[model samples]
Target chain A: MLLALDVMGGDNAPAETCRGALMACDRFPDLEVALVGTGSRVAPLIAEASSSVAKRLHVVNAEEVITMDELPSVAIRNKRKSSLRIAMEMVRSGEAQGCISAGNTGAIVAGGVLVVGRIPGIDRPGLGVPLPAIDRLRMLIDVGATVRSKPLNLVQFALMGGLYMRHVLNVADPKVALLANGEEEIKGDDVIAQARDVLRKGPFTFIGYVEGKDIPVGPADVVVCDGFTGNILLKVMEGLGEAVYALLREEMGQRILPKVGMVFMLPMLKELWTRFDYEQYGGTPLLGVRGAVIKAHGRSKAPAIASALGVARDFVLKRGVELISREITQGGM
Target chain B: MLLALDVMGGDNAPAETCRGALMACDRFPDLEVALVGTGSRVAPLIAEASSSVAKRLHVVNAEEVITMDELPSVAIRNKRKSSLRIAMEMVRSGEAQGCISAGNTGAIVAGGVLVVGRIPGIDRPGLGVPLPAIDRLRMLIDVGATVRSKPLNLVQFALMGGLYMRHVLNVADPKVALLANGEEEIKGDDVIAQARDVLRKGPFTFIGYVEGKDIPVGPADVVVCDGFTGNILLKVMEGLGEAVYALLREEMGQRILPKVGMVFMLPMLKELWTRFDYEQYGGTPLLGVRGAVIKAHGRSKAPAIASALGVARDFVLKRGVELISREITQGGM
Candidate 1:
């Protein structure tokens, strides 16, 4: 599978991106990678890798990089030679099976939708992020793309999320849930109520309405909602995680014995911390699209970028795009 | 100030409710308390209190109690003699300044709106809860009352939440923020964009759009949104708090030294725990109403009921209803 990487995308661009691509080459020997960025900027980092690994990496020169603050529509229109734009175009032209970018989310989302386009029957493509649970991770879709959605949109999200879990995470018949105010079928607004009705009658194993608290409990494999609510919930969890860690650190500093005990508990603490870390799980896939488009965080380091590349490669190998398109066309609400 | 309490409401009704009312009487000498519930259930608990304190409590007989499973609209219509309905009627009939209940939230909200009516010029009333932040408690409105709302409704929530923060929390020129997916003005859905436009030109110190992360950081005095997003955010925060506390308790039990350290840290831990405890905050006030109607948790204990009464008394004494009414009449939004 040929995967396009935006080498000049994230905060730690060129170096981390190049290093991550090299790492991916080592991990998956059969995978071909095209590093889409300025060749001069990425060559030094590529040189650090083994000669054989460097030989495996192909450089496609692109001059501009989209910044975090740039307007997404304008950036895509003006920066034709930008790495993020070019990478997405490669997938559109069939040069690459999938594309990965750790850059401006707006630009990435815009490029994925407007440039690469959505699947034939899909209403809107959604971004799915895996949330950490006690036993396993829960995939939350439409995290920040397509804010205003109809009941059919939510049903599509559930279908796509379930497919992603089945193919990628290897969870068959992933229990799908509609994020609502309560767990009752009669609860929630008109959108949720209608979605619940449609989902129950449509496809997949509908688990009825799941409350917001259930997201972390892992009762359901795929939780579906509009991008607005999903994005807000995702950020709230992230903020809460940061706040808890800060409070724990503060409490550990109040006494001498507790401080010593914290040192002893470092390994256990590290294990606990990894459960909430997003980088370990890699990039979020923009599902329900004609081709695979993965978005990594802007602050992602080498490990995160490498994980993103692996995710893109796996999506291509698993034929995620084709499966989702087929599912939507055959049984979509 | 006179406060009416539903003694037979909540999970620990009559017992904890009776004790909490007596505790409130002891704490504030000028406060008058009226316990409304079935005489058979509450008489014994009231008799358990000190004779002098018990003498100050007035017992009003209510025939029925609303169960958690009963629909709020149906409960209000059928259970006319219930504690929740009677207590709210007391406030409506001018027999009490404010009503407090730890009964069914849907019933409380339904009765509060139907019986007490909305404040003049207000569109829809909302449930407002104070979230415990790092530096201070931030007020979030429309927690779960009205699910479907327009941009105008959000503007009203901002006005009501701002007034509540200023009068109740004593914050001057309360900074108001629209809870959105992103901080950018151009970001979010159509409703959020319209809310931003309205808020930018309306009264109160608008702080622009605030992300979900800012809710717990206490960046704004008032965070406004439709009930759907607000309710989800509230429940997610509660779930995270419970999850963190549970993890901490388990960690404290892992070793002897850590257990010993936990003993010393118990007081501080308790203090931190209290900050996130919703029971301490008593009830969510139904803002944009003619008279104050407080809705406590359906699973509330007696202490929570008593605290709700205290909140009611404070709202009445401060003339919060009239102040907000006048503010709206004077074009607060």
Candidate 2:
């Protein structure tokens, strides 16, 4: 029931992380949070929160803060007292069932692998990120877990992703597909070609190839690819989303009629923005690990951190990580 | 200069192709086109045009048409008299300086290799596509030209992409960067890691690594990567653009004030759409080829085809293709 949180991670650390923990505590009655950060930094935020929210939260002091650009290997070796390390340690020692960090991605990936460790039979871990599409959130797996991937790894990714979607998200019979350049079977490189054959034999609903456009269109609930491709897709979608918003703002000039028109469209625009909101999706889970380790966005606010905690709770409750391990071991290709 | 046109290719076929050719001629006085397709199918479209516009257009007798889903190797071997083949043949025989097609991409790549051939020392060709960022166009080289690429191929891509940007797009000393998962020097796969080393020694201005987010932000004028990565980026961007538009439309409903606001924003929205318009980008040029061969979008209308013709003309006039051959051979990385 207890979750360790890296409060000193992300752009607006301690403050947002503490507030988000408070929000998650308020949202979930059974949840307890171990807020790992500097005591002095988190005390004021903890004081400001309501008594009911504060009762469910506890502070685990760790003074050192790892900057956004710090090397993951260096942090893993040198910064033993860092919030990310401390939070991860909590999960390792069984003090917390899961942990979340809104910090450096590289550090989180490294910390998850080195500290939390992979499940017994899993070859490699994959980050299953929920990318918000027009109608629903499409899970793009292996979004920079490990750059190098074998065909067998992609098949494992499909299994892990399907388990998460089916158990956590409650999507029954998740339709999985390989993320290829073209929809046709013969339209990919050697890795994809080999993965296609392996995926067909897996337990998930293996649909044919889905192109890049299909990611935003929601052709399949779970789209599996190598870490490199998945990372690029995830980041490009992020950048394009920003570019689109920038374009709309630039084009929405301060004309009299248009200015008045904006008032009417503000609610609708808000609604549209919320549809693709990352805050609701929370952090990404590095599935195939022994315990839940969520990588919240680098610039995560109170809402995003709260959503991530909710996801972490769901991950543990639904036994998603355990399910992946069992599935991969039993569904031997 | 004379150019070969594939009137039977694309969704709209001879009508859009003929109109696009006429528009290109009207825009550029010195241009002449040998429209290659069935004479029976193209006659009415040509006759329907004004006398002045039709004067520069000549229909070459190519009755065969290649379907979109046909296998590339099959299209190459079996459909010899297809419009795609006839246009490539025009480039090979010196009948025309260049050719343009809105047909099967795989087929175009195959014919370009089989008929037009590689430019002597060039090992493989790359498709240099102009993707419009908010600020300007960034040339994403090797957009599905060759899926599997070596370190040397990436070096060639940088040189070829740099030449196209400098000469054709008029961006002198374009900053070149390898597309990686992260911006850090060591943060990439083995192929990218080795390519990074090769790029530093190459002729162009080699700026280290650029992430997918950097593509829309316009950090580097030319972003080089293998075709698989490049194709995913290109297609994903296209799909995301569509998704955003769909989101806006769906959200715009529900309120009466938002409905009236749409009228005021329509012009600005139209202007914004034109900025990222694929038609404006024309088509991607198969850059390491012997002659200019631009691959227009398959669903291209008159405007896109017209833009592609303009691109083909620029490719020839600027000697982009020949320059790539010379640069790659002489650079000898």
lDDT digits (tens) for residues A1-333 of candidate 2: 999999998998888999999999999999999999999888888897777888888999997877878888788768999988999989988889999999888888888888888887788889999888888877999999878789878888888999899999999889999888788877888888898888887688899798888988966999998888888878888887788777677666645655666777777888777888899997899988889999999889999999999999999999887788778678764
Query: What is each candidate's fraction of native interface contacts (fnat)?
Result: 0.42, 0.68
Error of 2 at A134 (Å): 0.6
lDDT of 2 at B167: 94
Measured with C-alpha atoms, the lDDT of residue B47 in candidate 1 is: 75
For candidate 1, give the DockQ: 0.53
C-alpha lDDT score of every prediction, in listed order: 0.83, 0.86
Candidate 1 residue B139 Cα shift, in angstroms, is 0.7
Number of clashing pairs per prediction, in order: 2, 0
Model 2 over residues B193-275: C-alpha lDDT tens digits? 88888778757789999998888985799999888888888888888778877777766665687888777766776888788
Per-model RMSD to reference: 1.9, 1.5
TM-score of predicted chain B, candidate 2: 0.96
Off by over 4 Å in 2: none
The runs of at least 3 residues in candidate 1 whose Cα sits more than 4 Å from the true structure, single-residue gaps closed, are: A250-257, B248-268
DockQ of each: 0.53, 0.71
| Worst lDDT 10-window in candidate 1 chain B | B257-266
Error of 1 at A54 (Å): 1.4
Chain B TM, per prediction = 0.94, 0.96
